[model samples]
Target: MATGRSTVFEDRSHAGAALGMKLSTLLPAGEYTVLGLLRGGVPIAHEVAKTLGATLGAVAVRKLGVPSNPELAFGAIAQYGPDSARHINEAIYRRALQYFGKDELESLERGTGADLLALADTFKAYCPELAGRDLLLCDDGMATGATMKAALDLVQGLAPASIRLAVPVASPETAAGLAPQVNGICQLLTPDNFTAVGAFYEDFGQVGQDQVLEMLRATQ
Candidate 1:
């Protein structure tokens, strides 16, 4: 019952660490796996995995946007498992492509589908299988979730006993949308008027590939 001033949620890593502390108290005695949506998610997930004595792996997802308007996301694609890839596209990629130059469009086509398939293969080959397992999916924070929605859809194919989406903070709308798709959600803060993920965090720094690899190495 450490409920009081949660102002420390302002720090992304601190917020995530706090969330890990909270979840360790709440989860029941059972088997569970922690899967982080890298590369932003890896550090946060490492703590949870260590606390749970659970296996860890990456869930790679990419946002598909128009080549011209890379800022605008149309949908999300993810590498779920050895044989599962899923996409959730509320906005048509074609429309987003209008914003991109031809070169960027070709780049998108080249790097979209097959890359995710390879990523899924890597997740399955490198990490433990998640079938019928109680799984916890961790991330740095939530944006529109077009990318995460696709990742969760793919995780569903693994036939996990449950999928819990955990974040330190998120917008109420995003948390509400993901509620049905996930078995449960662990969000410490949910404000009605959310502008961006960074606004909630004090030190919203970049989590790059080097940081993720270092965390993985340390955990191993």
Candidate 2:
């Protein structure tokens, strides 16, 4: 884990290129499927797949945010094909229970699960088989890492040969927490005084579904 302040990315493209260079050296030679968590991750995965000559695909995962504060995630959901995974932050969930009933929480999960499946269906045509191939999961960055955890859980069930995670920047704590779950991890920057993922990029603009689809179509 690289500590202290590192260089900020000019944008997602620049970040992707830098991360792709790092991954080329770290990842072993194999048949790889680069699965980028949409929609911010697609651009980063584009550069990575090009660098490694790997098949590119997209994954859809949604955070199960608190009822009052949607930005505060209590859990997340991700789906691929017939498999789906959900991750709950027990501590946060417990705290949430104080303000809301169990039924309300379950409702939130159900809604997120539906949205995850629907979004995954949108990209199903682009995703390749993962059963025998090495998988490289890409994302713009992770703060709490709820969504990435959910993604990892879903991917693990598909029996991939190996799985690794790559990201441009991440909170050190979140990166450390996720390290044990993967074969390997390639993170460009893990800052101690961590802030939101967007703080490290100059143009952390909104990524629409159209842009994501275009990137996936180009890969195919």
Best TM-score goes to which candidate?
A: 2
Among these predictions, the greatest lDDT belongs to 2
| lDDT tens per residue, model 2, 22-127 | 9989877776899999789889999899899999998888999999998788989887766788889999999999899899999888887777778988888877
Model 1 Cα shift for residue 216 (angstroms): 1.8
Give residue 47's lDDT in candidate 1 (0 to 100).
76
Q: Model 2 misses residue 152 by how many Å?
A: 0.4
Tell me how many residue pairs clash in candidate 1: 7
What value does the lDDT take at residue 124 in candidate 2? 81
Find the number of clashing residue pairs for candidate 2. Answer: 0
What's model 2's lDDT at 17?
95
Output candidate 1 Cα RMSD: 3.8
TM-score of decoy 2:
0.94
lDDT of 2 at 195: 70
RMSD of each: 3.8, 1.5
